[model samples]
Target chain A: MGAPFNYDVLDLTDEQVDAEVRVFGALTAAVRRLNEATLRTTVDHATVEEVRRQVEELTARLEKSMIPDNFGVSFTKGGRIRGYGNAVVGIRNPNAVPLTVVQDKVNGRASAEFELNALHEGPPGQVHGGVVALVLDQVFGEAAAAGGSPGMTGTLTLRYRLNTPLGPCSAEAWVDRRDGIKTIVKGELRRADGTVTVTAEGIFILPRWAREEIAKNGGTPPQFE
Target chain B: MGAPFNYDVLDLTDEQVDAEVRVFGALTAAVRRLNEATLRTTVDHATVEEVRRQVEELTARLEKSMIPDNFGVSFTKGGRIRGYGNAVVGIRNPNAVPLTVVQDKVNGRASAEFELNALHEGPPGQVHGGVVALVLDQVFGEAAAAGGSPGMTGTLTLRYRLNTPLGPCSAEAWVDRRDGIKTIVKGELRRADGTVTVTAEGIFILPRWAREEIAKNGGTPPQFE
Candidate 1:
């Protein structure tokens, strides 16, 4: 038989990967718009039922393009994709906003930035509290990863300093302290004005999955999938 | 003029409330089904456009009704209806779930339970990890409320001991310790088999809003909302 249907076959150019990321973001924005319109209307059984039906149809249309059934992870001769499974825009997941996370060795620090859309709202005219925590967990985990331990967040503690508006925001994380599996990472999500709305401390664990996966890949960690 | 329209004045018999809860559960399940099918289908652009049109029509029809509009909290004189709002039923919110929290006589013991439907998925066959934390935070806050603090979560931490399966699950909480303003609480979410999928600890603070609300209410702690 021919070589297995590996991700290597679909070697995408850097430009193509960039385009994929953009498409995912646009689609997420569209979904958020639809959601807002639906919520702003009157509430009733019919409204509920109709929204459900319409959402069903929209979903069917969106997934028409069959990406590989496997999870988002890739390793090739070129480079590795990091922080690819973010719910909004991900290279491996066409459905999320595959955010590109980077660690700047020049500064020996980790930072990330991404745009938020309507799909992430919790209260009226505000982003969901949990989404803020999710991003914080990811950013903090990135910091932990910098120290050679990619992990799953074991405990994440967040204070909703304020109502985080839905729009462009940046997150930064730095290793504050470490005690074996208990890594204390401090992270913040800030607005364009540099006002911080969310702050977090997370304790992440070097789960068995990540440890084994790293060893199997010859020390090349498949970016957070 | 009639009292300003209070959004909290509808009443149902215990049986009626239970029935509404059941319907709410079913509708949430349908939303999930819609999400999964949408993610897996391969419809053409033209078909998707057509579906969008149908959705608009459904939206119009649903808006014509008023039940979901008239849903929310309610209080009345005697057993009869004085004012009424939808109390966790009436699909006014796609993401809404009814939480019933009961505080114990002891200073820091409390318990809560609620149902999750399709609108709360993260991974393929599991409850979204963030949602798990959301539920935990709310319950732990409720437990702190047991001590009559009526505080907000300053720092909430969760451990994903295992993947929480999609279906009926029970969660519980109790006071762990107290240090002045910070009331530490612990809780867990479990499947029917008693396997704890998630556990949490929270630091709750007696926020300014709560303190003021309590004082204005004649020092009697407000019941769970």
Candidate 2:
């Protein structure tokens, strides 16, 4: 009947949104470095313990005042989105593969070029297969949104053809077609050399609540995952 | 024919492995707190920048003398593993949901009890669907390994039956059967109250090299994903 929850439309200037993106994006990048170091570090135990205490103090400083809950998708009066907590592309999520997909609305396509480092390994040097799925799900969702019929991921299928090594990689997805309320999106994961490693297809459907809302109120739904 | 990259069987003792786990695991836990604060913090920009500088300095201290590359699965002489870089269960990986999966080799099953906080949110208070798949993939792989047929994931299929609310959750997976070199694993994600929210099936295949090594050289394969 209505939105699920927390898709708040806020009153903020475009400049304000851009500043949040910049400041928070930088913080996320720094935290990712700390994440990688947490894995790869060979510092002495004393130094590590010291760093832990320092980290705890910094975290406490930030936690002095905080949000009540998750940073849900927010839209500005100017239509700019602050979906910064997304698991795939969330600027604030260190756990993210941390990708930003470019949506080409005219062609119903989405693509992103990013790097997978030591933090993303699965079979030794290769990227974890689930991480690939995480990135694909978001990209495919964006493609559905770009196609002008946004929805939730109904089902995603992936075939691992080869190993995706830890390094620079790219992904491309486009809407194949639409079937009633469903949009079928096709995509592939590629190595830096442009060799395909995984191919995926997903069916995204307009949720019944959103569909009912649209039928009753008559407006396009939010174009986000 | 040999193991892929860095699954090195090291010469460390159980005590050494235990100490490393304690230290690195603590570091990861601290980093995770910083990660959450990075998102939830509402302090002034000056405070954010100063915290960022401190984080960078701490990370640098840890990275002084680090491993050359990915922390591939390593085994101690006493039989404990240092797969601390895993995405789902890696204790050293802050990006991980950081669960400690318990393997029941006798029953060819594996399970874990963990929590998903605001960081794992997708649909407002609900856990992200892709995050659900990520957890299932790891649990299914462990089940295959426990069943005495470790392998890479060939294909994983998931069905989201209901929204898994953010908070405490548990996952259980077991070997349903084996088809030649392939092990079929089935699992489900449950909310804190034990309600099933997502179901999954994954096909894990012992790679050709490992299979050939066993067939030609005559021994069981490694029992770890």
Candidate 3:
């Protein structure tokens, strides 16, 4: 890799970070519930319009009362605050499947548990094939980053072996190899019954810009462990 | 790969499909607005809790009055009725980026246009890198299917060329080659100024089970054109 991952720890306590993550998690859960309701709601047109107006007004009110920008990612000595507004694993993103992941650096592996609700469906009863790709890519990237090299995704390859059914699913990934600036990771999504649904391989690279940014900031990147 | 694409005309007017698509598009747009607001809102704790409760109550009411489940994909004679509840491009999915895609079979190519809002952010002021993968996979799959080889994704490789900004972006994909069951498609996501942000190549395979399912059901598969 161009340079080792590094980050300067912030002076935040673990308790504070946990509380923040929990609060965001609650909000995301509520929003997810709302999203599903929106998809399946079939109320009369009048009722629908009324509810829409109320939601719009609420949005306007909140906008007027809230901060103007996002509180991007933050780091602390404990680790990279995992609950930053990440689209993939952020507890604050209602769009996320909100996978709970465990990275095992000693074993050079990472695993996640998640459920694909109706919101993720593609085929009538199966998970969207593309969603499968999305999950696999995230897990594989995590695996690559876990191996002491935090790099941006250079390439991701996936194989759909079977239709991933909607409901609980598990995924696991591991670093298969590394070549200087390139790190290759392999992973698979599996059903509860251990039936493999999708398999993936990805190549991650430490770009020059990322290296320069890390160097300029004088921050140490968090190790996957 | 497993079987050639096939389809039988259904009795559906283009007007009917367009009308339905538009209706769903409006609903998704509303939901998308709600999602963005949920992300950026920063009201006081008391007000936030109050709004959350109200949203919850509304959700409960809607649940009692709405449809029981999603109205999965539907096919029509004019085409595949591309506006099905697809997780990627379906107008019915509030979670989707809602890319507007046009598959030009006459030229053996496919392209899409979409915008990423604050909700899709990963890094500060930038579109989430995983989202780039998500969009590319869908476009590449569309390209493979556009070439008359409507298969599942076998493998997809993406190269991040530059940071995709959080705003209007366009992507295009085309078949590079085909080998029996495998179709290779190449694509790139570009900024409004035509700066290439990410490039990808994917291999798609028509699985044996999918071929059998089409044969069992009297349903004809939609052609890419």
The residue-by-residue lDDT of candidate 2 on B1-225, one tens digit each, is 123443567899888888888888888899999999898888888888889888889988988989877777777778887778877778888899877788899999999999887688665566777888788888888988888878888888777666677789999999999998789999999998999988888889966754664566454555664
Tell me candidate 1's interface RMSD: 7.8
TM-score of chain B taken alone, every candidate: 0.60, 0.90, 0.83
Please give, for residues A28-101, the per-residue lDDT of candidate 2 as tens digits: 88999999999999988888888999999999999999887677677888999777787788888877788879
> What local lDDT does model 1 show for residue B60?
57
Clashing pairs in 3: A5-A221, A6-A220, A6-A221, A7-A219, A7-A220, A7-A221, B10-B77
Q: Is candidate 1 or candidate 2 better by lDDT?
A: 2
Q: Could you give candidate 3's per-residue lDDT for residues A55-90 as a string of tens digits? A: 676667657754354435557877646435556676
Error of 1 at A58 (Å): 4.9
- For the predicted complex of model 2, DockQ is 0.57
Best-performing candidate as measured by lDDT: 2
Residue range B84-147, candidate 1, lDDT tens digits? 1111212323333445556785767766556554334433334556567756665676678777
Predicted complex 1: DockQ: 0.20
True interface contacts reproduced by each model, as a fraction?
0.19, 0.64, 0.47
Q: Report model 3's chain A TM-score.
A: 0.86
What is the lDDT, from 0 to 100, of the residue B88 in candidate 2? 75
Candidate 2 residue B93 C-alpha distance from true site, Å? 0.7
Chain B of candidate 1 achieves a TM-score of 0.60
Measured by TM-score, the strongest candidate is: 2
